[model samples]
Target: MDERSALGLLAGWVDAAGDDAAVIDGLVITTDMLHARTDFPGGTTRYTAGWRSIGASLSDVAAMGGTATAAVAAYGAPAFDAEEIAAFVDGANDVCDLTGAAYVGGDLDDHDEFTVAGTVVGRVDDPVFRHGAAPGDAVYVTGTLGRTGAAIREFERGNVERGNELFRFEPRVATGRRLAGVASAMMDSSDGLARSLHQLAAASDCGFAVEWDRLPVDRAVDAVADDDAARRELSTFFGEDFELVFTGPRAAVESTRGALGAPITRIGRVTDDGVLADGDPLPDRGYSH
Candidate 1:
């Protein structure tokens, strides 16, 4: 199946069963586990990687419109060292407390590579779904785009240390909450911006026009990628910029921006067909998992 279709399949399951809330409230999973067998600061081989995984997943869950009420997780270890496992447990609970998501339950397994997976449960009053956009609607994105991608690029080049904004993006839980009525369709851009836009456009059965010149590049990123041409180049296919993208009528667009109180950039317009920039096709994948 195509990438978009895969995501749609998952979303379909949610929609078919997600009968709890309206435009803003429903049963939603906030986070997914993230891990690093190497390059993690707490000693790559340490148990903290699992903790990072849980944090990353929780971030995903909280980014959507939910309170991150509870979580279920399973952990895999190579040797199951007592100390290492204990540390992993500590990491998990710490994140649970940190994010206000209750630690419901999880399992541990014996394995080679470290692995952690979490399922987060939360609620929304009137849920903002992945489908439904109209032609002539404006597209809005919270915060800046291309920061995570830029951070990855810089990290790869040995440019910065940990704790960079691009590498670790806090979920836009509040923005997602305020977006319900204002946004016709809403989704988190965990994938590249280009791919997420495609998902939103196809779901709404509409088209898009990206203003390549103003993609909200970060300051340090702009200094290096430095120009519209460069930002356009990086923002296209770079992945993991977990920002939020939504679409709505002109009025809804304004209200979302105003209510969210975040820098919402009008990157494009919803169209009658598919993607278009200045009436042309957008190149590259932006962020695809």
Candidate 2:
């Protein structure tokens, strides 16, 4: 089965397994694993790998509108260079700093391949869930889309330096925290905006109608794609942006933008029908591995 389908099966077997993170008491916890060979492209730095892996887990906490507290990593690799290991730790620490979280250290093991398993702990005054969006709610996304997609394309073209700039994404921790009181539903767009909308729609039993013109397509996509249509596809369907996709009252969403002093784009509205882009049906397309 595909990753989403497998996860769906697991969710069916487990209780309260659909959220981005697990909330216990007032703490929110989440984890993620990254395989070096699969997740990182050739020429990717060890530092970038560590940063992205840890940040990915923290992004889940952010999706729940949580304030990150601490994080740990489990690293497995073959006989790797000591400098590479040091750079990896530094990257993890840097990401923790960005999220206002502590790097508590973690276990390391020798293996045939490189891999990282990361976990983050956080707290939220009011947790947002994918299931909370109501019809008529405004759907918003933080920052521009397709940056990672552009980065990947650049990497494939041997422009590793430029690609790294987009690969190392900033998790929307601060914005998410500020949105806690306002947003009704929230999730990180690591799975691409299109698939994310589908997931949110399924969770909330509501659909989405996104405005094509309103999507914050990153200009970086222009460097990778041939035309506007391809750029739009990359921005909407490529994954690993690490930006928050949220829903709230239109007024509250505007207030959130002012409160956080961050870019928040109104992309769509929640609805009773199926997902649509510019009134046309939008497929659930994104990275699934």
Candidate 3:
């Protein structure tokens, strides 16, 4: 079964079934695992891997509109390289620093492949959820899209410098906090904007109508693809951006954007109808693993 299906089978026993993180007595907890062979690219550094692995779990806390408190990781490798291991720890600490969390250290083990499993703990006063959206809510996204997709393409093409932009994503923790009071529903776009919207719709029991022209396609995509359609595909369907996709009243969303001084873009509106792109149906496309 897919992750979602597996989780669904056990949903009845959990306090929160479909959110990015689980909450218990105000504490938010989440975990993520990464395999070096599959997740790390040729040019990816140990530091980046460690950072991304820890950041992935922290991003779930952000999705819940929580402040990170602490994180721990489980690292496994065939053999230890002192320098690389130090770099990995440094990277993990760096991400924890960015998210205002502490790295409390973790366990190490020997394995045939390199793996990192990171878990983060956090707290939220009023946690935002994926199921609270209602008809007429305004859909918004923070930062530009397609950066990750473009970055990966650039890396494959041997442009490491440019590709690094997408490889290192900034989790929208601050933005998520700022939006907690206003957003009716919230989630991070680690699964691509289109898929995120679909997931939100499923959770909220509503629909979204996105305006193609309003999508904040990352400028970096221009370097990767020449055609507008291809650019749109990458921006909308490729995952790993770690940006926030949320919904709220139009006024509240606008005010929050102004107050936070962050790049929040209005992409669409929630409705009773199913998801659409400029009035047409938006295809279900994104990263699935």
User: What ordering of candidates by lDDT runs from best to worst?
Assistant: 2, 3, 1
Model 3 compared with the native: what TM-score?
0.95
* Candidates 2 and 3, the one with greater lDDT: 2
TM-score of each: 0.77, 0.97, 0.95
Candidate closest to the true structure, highest lDDT:
2
lDDT of 3 by residue, 1-289 (tens): 8876787777767768668999889899998888866677677778888888898888888889999999999999998899988998998899889878999999999989888899999998899999899999999998999988888888799887666546777777777888898999999898899999999999999999999999999889888888988898889998888888999999978876666535989999999969999889999888774
Residue lDDT tens for model 1, 1-289: 9755685577676653221122234566544544444324322333345445655555455344555677677877677688877776666676667657676768888867666776667775666665777888888778877766576666666655532434555556566666767788877666667777776776567788877666776665665585667776566656555567778888757855667746788887887876876667865375433
Worst 10-residue stretch by lDDT in candidate 2?
Answer: 253-262
lDDT score at residue 146, model 1, on the 0-100 scale: 71
List the global CA lDDT of all models. 0.63, 0.89, 0.87
Top-down TM-score ranking: 2, 3, 1
Off by over 4 Å in 2: none
| Count of backbone clashes, every candidate in sequence | 19, 0, 0
lDDT of 2 by residue, 200-237 (tens): 99999999999999999888998899988789778999
Clashing pairs in 3: none
C-alpha RMSD values across all candidates: 4.4, 1.2, 1.5
